[model samples]
Target chain A: MAEKIKILYVDDEPGNLIGFKASFRVDYHVLTAVNIPQAINYLDNNPDIKIIFCDQRMPGKTGVDFFEEIRISHPLPVRILLTAYTDVESIIEAINRGNIFRYVKKPWAEADILSSIDEANKFYTANSMLMVKNEELQKAYAELTKFAYSVSHDIRGPLSGMLGAINLAGEIDDIEEIKEMLFLMGKSLTKLDTYILSMHDYYSLQRGELKITNIDFNKIIDDLKAMYMVISKSNKIVFTTTVDQGEVFRSDEVPLRLILNNLLSNAFKYQDKKSTNKSVEVSIEVHKNQAIIYVKDTGIGILGNHIGEIFDLFYRANFQEAGSGFGLYNVKSAILKLGGNIEVNSVLHKGTTFKIIIPSI
Target chain B: MDKEFSFIIIDDSELDCFVIQKVIERAFKNLDIISFQNANNALEAIKEQGVKTKPTIILLDIQMPLMNGFQFIEEFEKFSPQIQDCYTVIILSILSATRAPADIHTEFNKRIVGSIIEKPFTIEKLLSLLKNMGLADEKIVLSGKKLLP
Candidate 1:
């Protein structure tokens, strides 16, 4: 409507083609093509042409066939078909192939033809706007992820130095109180370390290209237990497993470890502060083409409303509790990457459980 | 952990270079200290040092006028093996947080320069660092007073 709307008109009848060229040719650059090949050639020659009009009743190839083939080879113009009521089947087929934006009846009025072109132009503009908005959104998301990654790296480096100094504080003998202080420092470091590690995994999940591997679920559990042996001993946490004994699954090992580590750490971190009885139970079960790992903790359980967004990035269920807010986010992302899913179940002041399901294959 | 070595710090900023100099001094008491207000004169004095029998560690300040720490490292790197061996350049600055010692380690390796130590160094921090720098001493004697027996 602004200026110089271009269109390609295809028909077998020379008279009808002339008629189309005569009507509304003043405001438009109208190209006439007698066959499918000529129409394709015109489209290639004039790229600025914004709309396409094809006539269904042709000698050799019908408009529907031409439109279907146009999809693969050509970046189509907004397509409209001029066909008789008898060619309804062909018109319907064209629509199904996503070839035609609309259909016009034969012996079309000049004003009707002009309006159709106007409608297609508006539709084209709206589609372009949607595409631009999508691109901008993607760019914004990428920048936010980059900022999170940098913050994680900066925070971790200093945290490392802090932990190193704290660990070295044990050598001085006169400062007997420093021993108790080191215990507190170690606990805080563990809390800080957990938060930082969760952040690290979250950043990696958002920005990383994962390295996947085949793993035996039972073996992974055993290794995890070995890794946390010291912590389990100090806390007097009795860990129990209900795995199906010998089961193997294939997925990315790195994220899988992250998911399990976070779950296991949380099971330890949020234990009932008052209750002397402390323990954790983990189980692995398989359903056709998918494997489920259940991490059940006898700890400070989650609230009902907060259960909805447990996996939201940096979303903390318990503000007072020591958490980095990235654990569940990483768990969700890793599971998604493996073409799997995760869910949570909890009862306030009772217990919390995470069901992590990865594709068994 | 790294090999223990003698070191010196040259800076007009007493509070600025205080902790770092003490670190080198206590960790390796064998280290000699050289304090300077300007790097240009330091460069001139270093160039005249002709030759030395043993390595004399040099911790160069980066913010000094006429020539900064990097420029000094560039010039010090060009000196004869006797002088270069004695010269180890540490770009002591407070602003460059992300600039790590690894950059100097990679470029200089065992030659061109030493390492970077972000400024406002503390005794507690430096002592821990020196321990890792291959000082066999089990305890880092606190700076200001003699270690309690």
Candidate 2:
């Protein structure tokens, strides 16, 4: 069942307050105050009060004055005025200055009060939703500006480098030096290709819906091994995998592949070049409808301060190697879409490990 | 043409550094060139060399990881006048001209910065810049190969 809507009623007469509470307490969480100070206290304490009713001709202040003051302080609540005397000037003032939604007579009908409450609640709901969407639109606008700046920098940075290299190639006469320039140009193209692929993955992950199916850990691990075989062999890094899955495991294959590919690529990319005993280990265990996987590598591990910010968009820990800084952010987003959690453990110059656990949907 | 001056290239991209070094080398005979991949490391080297370092023209890239070109100028401003006066900086970046000039006017130290050069720097641009600075008028060598004598 839906929760009851809360409403506030303020009056100078205690009898009127009690009667108002008794009438509406069954359908609403009704709060009543006898004086202006007490009414302000109720508003301060109860932020979720959606509808407000104030009676005119109070002791110290009029209901119109109270509504006018709260129009700035508590603008989200719908305000209504209740008065015994039918003064046309004050009623017009209440509508124009006090911003009251409706004015009811002293001898109000039960049906009229109920209908006013219903309309006021509907206005409150629509206003709250508008505020939420306005905030979201502002946030997306800021993100889009930052995204545009980063995209230009990432793409142009490499192309400019290539142009510089090509100009140098024309003036040089030594074949070996020219060959070296060609090698560097090849590296730049590779960086460009990697960045484009990451952009594609980012777009699809944002727009595509998840497709869940029964996942076979062994088959996925074998495929990964085959994909990375040549690079692992050339780099002299031993890659090993072990999977202990005795029960069924289900997940979205695309995101799962994205997560593993990113993690495994980083494991191979950040290895200490001088380290002779380079290795990567992958271990997975599935039980109790959860899959726990670990990807460990012997690499130049991340510094302690950078671990917290590694998942942020366009954050790079080091400039020693070329990267678009989208790899780990995509990994984290994919893991979140699969309802999974990941933890990182690392020691500088030693190694780093990522442990992830995902539950079957 | 015996007056000696060194060139310092500060850019994070190794390939850009290599290209700039080659371009500078081809234009001048036996000119000293130093390149650092990190801005902080370059600052450390400058401080270590102190006032004894040779008169230098620094080619600085704007977008770096830890310290940017403007931040490097901010640090450079704290040096003694004797050391500071020995170097002049020129920005080398891929930033658009409309934005780069405005940033240089507002954020950079006017006295220390000589000018701004867009990326993919060529030898002709470098020689033209040196001529404008009065450093190419018989004081600096022009390698005599496809260069204005």
Candidate 3:
């Protein structure tokens, strides 16, 4: 059943307040106030009140005056001023100033007031939705500006480095020296390409719709291990995984892979060179429709102060290497889109561990 | 005799470090240039070297993965004045239009940053800047190529 729409009827006359409550009590959560102070009290207490009706002739405050005053604090509720036929000029001025949604006649008919309440409720809902969407649009716009700046700076920085190497390569004739320059140029190109690809993933993750399906944990784990095989060997870090899933787990696969790949690569990237024993351990368990995953790494761990902001966009916890700075941020966005939560634990020079719990869709 | 100085290249970009290293190597002989991709690692090195380190010149990048140029300077400020005053920190970045070096120097003081140089820098600009700061006394020669007319 739909929740009852709350309505507050304010009138100086006690008889009118009683009549208003008696008429609409069945359909709405009807609240009655004898004066402006009582009406203001009701509004303050019941924030969810959708429609407000006030009598034009009150002790010290007119209905229009009360409506205008409440516009700032109680703006969400639709305001309706009740006035006599002789008060046409005031009603016109109040409506012109956009203080009230509509004005009801002094001797309001029960049927007429009921229809007005229904219309006012719909208007209130639409207004609230617009406000929410506007806020979202503003936030997205801000992020877009940041994205533009990041793309240009990150992409051009590498390109310029490659350009300089190429210029120098043309002037040098020695094969060995040219070979070294070519190697550096190749690395610059690779970095630039990777940044572009990550930018693509960031956008798609934000705008793409979730395609929920049965997720094969074994296959995903195999792919992850294969992907990081070279890096693990190069860095001399042992990689291990333990998966325990009895029944088939279901979730979106693309984002799942995105999250795992980023975390694993970071494990390899930030390892301490001096540490003799470097390793990454992955554990996944699925039971009772929830998949719990843990990726722990014996790497140069994040600082205590940076732990909270590590997942924010373009926030790098360690300056170990030049990266897209979107890896953890994208992981966080993908996890959130799947209605999951992730937590990080770390100590300086020790290691970092990430725990994630995602309920199956 | 010219005062000998070492350098710390605190940039996340390996390519930027490579280019800068080449420039330095080509222009001068027998100079110590230490490069770190991460600021924290550089901080560790600075702490170890302490006052024994030479009058070091730091080429710092503004936009880095962890601990940007400004954040690194904030950490650098925690060192003793003896250690702090021995180094010249210069902001080298592609983000010149967005961030002003003078503004940062005013905010952090000249003790933190000597100046800013926009990226895609040439050896000529770098050597001249060093000379102006009185860090380079020997005439810089760029691989049989004259950087100054």
The model with the greater lDDT, 2 or 3, is 2
| Model 2 quality (TM-score) | 0.85
Order by TM-score, highest first: 2, 3, 1
Whose TM-score is greatest here? 2
Comparing candidate 1 with candidate 2, which one achieves the higher TM-score?
Answer: 2
Clashes of 2: 0
The candidate that wins on lDDT is 2
Q: Estimate each model's TM-score.
A: 0.43, 0.85, 0.83
Which segments of model 1 are wrong by more than 4 Å? A1-196, A210-212, A245-248, A319-321, B1-149
lDDT of each residue in A61-163, candidate 3, tens digit only = 7887888888888889998878785556886877865478877787999878988998998899999999999999998998887777787677878877777
List runs of model 2 lying over 4 Å from the truth. Answer: A1-49, A54-75, A85-100, A238-250, A285-293, A357-359, B1-3, B138-145
Best by DockQ: 2
Q: What is the lDDT of residue A331 in candidate 2?
A: 95
Better of 1 and 2 by lDDT: 2
Displacement of the residue A188 alpha carbon in candidate 1, Å: 5.2
